[model samples]
Target: MSGRIDLGLLVAALTAALALSPAAAAPQAGVMDARAQIAAAPSATITNGLITATVLLPEGDKAFYRGTRFDRSGVVSALAYKDRQFYGPWFDRISGEVRDFAYDGDDIVAGPNTAMVGPADEFDFDTPPGWAEAAPGGVFVKIGVGVLRRPDDAKYSPFRTYDLVEPGRRTVKIGKDAVTFTHTLAEPTTGYGYVYAKTLRLPKGQPRLLIAHSLRNTGTKPIVTTVYNHNFLTFGGAALGEGLSITTPFQITSGRPPSAEAAAIRGRSIAYLKTLRDKDRVSSSIEGFGTTAADNSATVHDDGLRAGVTFHGDHPLSKMQLWSIRSVVAVEPFITLVVPPGQEAHWTYAYDYAAA
Candidate 1:
């Protein structure tokens, strides 16, 4: 008899068992009488049974500033499910040194900053002349929508920036099952005319949070861009060490395999190779995805806390990346879309938390 267990086969067997289990036979019931409120500070909070989420109002707290004086809105700081918080300060804080730059004959300078999440369209910045010579203190601001040259173009690059400022929000109740926080950005800034809206919802009884977003190109130009959710997840203050596993529906292919000393991949999952010490890091850009949104789901299980979170995208994934350090773990999912003039693009994401 063999004493060693084959992890890959074990996972396969367990997956088969789950599919046949009675618990998977029907949909679970959801919570009831869920409600969302806006505090005096203008922050928004949604509470339903054991699930609660606080979305920091851009006007109230300066914690998640994007390091830019212009377009100082449209960022949400913290989201929590019980004791587990999904977002936090960036791993690297910006240096305090301030430098000056000239944009459209106006002087621009770096502003007070902190880490941000879910900012979009990262690859559309114009490297200003002498930008490399300036002091490195400004935080990277990479959220917007626009059209640009495709990857294969070699001669010209159309790197445009947009200012989708802080949105206006309202709360709405839908039937008896869920409450939604709807945020809208209607006015165009920085030459982009578009209608952008994001809704955050908490359903009754279900241990999940839903985020739905829509973008309409009201301008005369077509909007060709990619958007991603930069999920900065901190598992209830649990350290990023051993007993952490990331599971995907499909095989993973990265530029380099997880370090043998840090993590291992078995079947369709990746688990920590060993407990990571302080300052230890693991980062990678992963591929190997199918053609459907169901193929783009992943789960992060924290064995130490006996809890986990599953992230799902309702749109086909264009790319995926992962980054982790001592403090936080980020799983980024990218989606590509094109909105012709007078057309719109839409997508949804859901986060479900569980505990053993």
Candidate 2:
């Protein structure tokens, strides 16, 4: 067996000065396995032998800007939102209504038609006259323009977009005999007044099992942002015979609080998130009850027949986000319910695969 410290140093050296395709960058970390491969910039395969997992990196070096660690205890991943592009309206906005502030899945542009967001605009909240209602658009544009983009900066407001960067590359390191893969972003990008981002990848080598991780910065200035991990999984036309069960530290709120409308979704309806269809998509909440006083941790997972999946959060993260893709569940942990600035410490999430 290889020493832990030695393995880390060796992988770091090989990925230190590496750059690959902008659509899907794969650094020759080790070997490849047969799960699936897509023509994306930041994706990984075993360069030599068979491994249990593969790492998928997003282009534009935006995947790994958040950190450099991979998943071994399980599949590890992070959620990255660059610049003021994703922040929505809060406080005030006369011309821009709440609908313009919420996030619509259309603009995400992750794949041919896949989006981190659902069909409807999520996160649209109601507020007083000064604090306008958010429908769902671009968070950064809503926050930046509705509040910051006053007549003073209205001119430059039109130029802001969430497209982080054109694209980037990704690399992966397959550990020996262990279900671990390390992914690193090739470069970073600038947006929302911030100049940092890395490529992130989600590699699933086993049936109904997957892992992911990312590195990112909220920006040098304070910007209200919400980091949500949206996962998309499936059962290949399988029925919910055993049904889907989720466990989290938070007590799970019944409905959205008085402050947010979009979050005003009912948890009881979607708690078990069985089968998801295009029309069955909507925004909801997964309230945490363990500890909300300050930054804390939360763990969540689903019990799958013959197996199960678990996700955990470590330091730097405080909240979790859940979205459904067809039959897949998007699990996201956040630093703050609403990220302002300089709030990032160290955060984590895990995907544990075990027998049912």
Candidate 3:
């Protein structure tokens, strides 16, 4: 017990915690009834045609797990974690308990542990009610350029400058019968924050998608930022070595070799996409994106297939971390955004998906 959190130990701790904690409310059960939804569901049951194999994040207002049939059967699909508890109280106030979300059978895969799934923060663009997980202000927004170095001083303070410019939630139309739920900000979390997500209803629907925007302040006073998304994808019943295909046109900026644990979690993640060029597939016609005041943009044509995602943020290199459990992939996007107490920054990324 070195005190450092390891996956196995963390899993056990989470299990025990959930096993002992009595549910504040009864588990909701129904096919399409919103009122019959719940935060935690037993992994022993089934949803639609999939089986609920594993339960992740059993300790908070949210608990995420997988459906039957997909690869990595019974895995975590969504949850939240923070480096500190100072903000826990605030988060507990505005955020709602997690709900059951089914996935669309076409195009992409999904998994447990996807951040910001289900509904938007009840407070919408309002500052968090309190610091529950990552202090009050530390909301996964990493710092530094190229190298990620969280600010030393104001690490997890409250988000004093954070404000909600936009108050209503809107669904973005994506292909036929496909839409994403999002909340736009006038005074966004960083510079301009757009969270694109959805709540899955059954087997023929799509899981939620979240794309957070933040900015970084360079020493030259040049405002640099990046756009990142913590997309949790699952391919239920699919194996890791099946040569999962990803098509994209953006440049592969880096290659993050998988950790030994990552290799164990899922084999494909062992060869993650550090940079765009490293991808096994690509589009010759598509190039880069146009420049905007906040960040750059790139276009990725899937050729009617499920391709990789790309973004332009304030940071130099757009980074993505691949986490997996056999059939699912969490392509977490991130950039250097300086929210160092007094400094201000922001960035954005536009994302889309297609079925291969």
Highest lDDT: which candidate? Answer: 1
> Cα miss at 291, model 2 (Å)?
3.5
Show where candidate 3 strays beyond 4 Å: 1-228, 235-241, 246-315, 339-344
Model 2, runs deviating above 4 Å: 1-17, 21-42, 46-51, 59-113, 116-225, 235-242, 256-283, 288-304, 316-321, 337-344
Per-model RMSD to reference = 16.3, 13.2, 17.2
Tell me which residue pairs clash in candidate 1: 30-204, 30-205, 31-204, 31-205, 73-166, 74-166, 263-273
Tens-digit lDDT track of model 1 for 123-227: 222331112222332112222321111222132222122222233332232222232333232223223356655556666778887777777766655556666
Predicted structure 2: lDDT: 0.29
Worst 10 residues of 3 by lDDT: 84-93
Q: Which candidate number maximizes TM-score?
A: 1
TM-score of each model, in listed order: 0.65, 0.44, 0.31
Q: What TM-score would candidate 2 get against the native?
A: 0.44
Model 2 Cα shift for residue 354 (angstroms): 1.8
lDDT of each: 0.50, 0.29, 0.26
